[model samples]
Target: MISATTILTFIGMATATYCSRILGYLLLANRVLSPRARAVMDVAPGCVLISVIAPHFVSSRPEEIAALAITLLAASRLSMFPTVVIAMTSLGVLKSVFN
Candidate 1:
């Protein structure tokens, strides 16, 4: 059960986080970015994802690693709705078996 205080705290955090993103976009959207800047922006997400996720994956516990493996296996074997269902099933089984 969520208390009123917890609800307000969640709302406040969400609003602040959203405003920070909106503010950044508002500042950048008005100016035309250079070709180099645009290219960097395009590549940034993959770089950021690699940097962020690679550390977590490399540093993962055995169970988390197992779950990741299952997710990847599911990814390879399924498509569309089946892919989503298979991934979620993998997640459930992995969590139960490993954790």
Candidate 2:
């Protein structure tokens, strides 16, 4: 069973993530950004994604490495929702096959 602590942790993490994503938009809502600044903002999420997944590149497990490659490819070629779906599906399959 999930403990109360675990559930609260999940909630806290969710809130933090949501706030981080929205905070920048809120702060800049009244300002006009230059083209360069807009471009940087657009790619900020990808940078966050890279930071989260970069450590997995050093993983010794073949499944994890393969899944990361698949995720990178999907992220490059597809939208965020489809990329997440493909990444999750590929990781699940790769883990089962490798194990």
Candidate 3:
């Protein structure tokens, strides 16, 4: 069974998430971003992705680190689908061999 504090925390988090999303929609509705703002927004997704993935990478084994490096290099030279495939394949092979 869950404690009362844990339940309340979950409810609080859900409410905060909903409120922030709704507020953002209301504020941005029918509005155009400046070119500078748009450029920042364009970079935001990749930056956010890196921020989220960085922690996992930091805790990864050497093989995982090598896989990430290979993936990044592939990403620079290839498209998204191919990069993802290469990354997955490399990670699988490395994990199998190293583990």
Candidate 4:
């Protein structure tokens, strides 16, 4: 079994990654990034998502991927609070059932 600490670390890292995106936008409005760096940033999100999600999908079982896909789809239309509620509940249920 994956230790809770390992799971927590992964969640923490993902959260930090998301927080850094908001920080980048906030800092960008106040200051400027280099043109070269800005160009890279513009094309980064798709690459980053594919890189992260690809292996996650590969490693996860079908039910895990199904829940993740549903979360991703719903997140487009859902508010942050509801999204969090749904995601947490779904993950808790799925993990409990599977593991």
Q: Whose lDDT is greatest here? A: 2
The TM-scores of all predictions, comma-separated, are 0.39, 0.70, 0.52, 0.52
Instruction: State the C-alpha lDDT per candidate.
Output: 0.53, 0.72, 0.62, 0.61
Better of 1 and 4 by TM-score: 4
> Which is the winner by TM-score between candidate 2 and candidate 4?
2
- Best model per TM-score: 2
Worst 10 residues of 2 by lDDT: 9-18
Report how far off residue 14 is in candidate 3 (Å): 22
Regions more than 4 Å wrong, model 4 = 1-3, 32-51, 79-85
Using TM-score as the yardstick, the better of models 1 and 3 is: 3
Q: Which parts of model 3 have CA positions greater than 4 angstroms off? A: 1-31, 56-60, 79-81
Error of 4 at 84 (Å): 5.8
Candidate 1 lDDT over 9-60, as tens digits, reads 5355445544645665777888899999767654543343233234437745
Error of 2 at 45 (Å): 1.0
lDDT of 3 by residue, 1-99 (tens): 335674565355445544545665677777898899757644543453354336547855977788888878897998544755576667667877887
The CA lDDT at 4 in model 3 is 67
Query: Between the candidate structures 1 and 3, which one is better when assessed by lDDT?
Result: 3
Query: Candidate 4: TM-score?
Result: 0.52
Tens-digit lDDT track of model 2 for 33-57: 9999988877765565566568889
Model 2 stretches astray by more than 4 angstroms: 1-21
Each prediction's number of clashing residue pairs: 0, 0, 0, 0
**Judged by lDDT relative to the true structure, which candidate is superior, 3 or 4?**
3
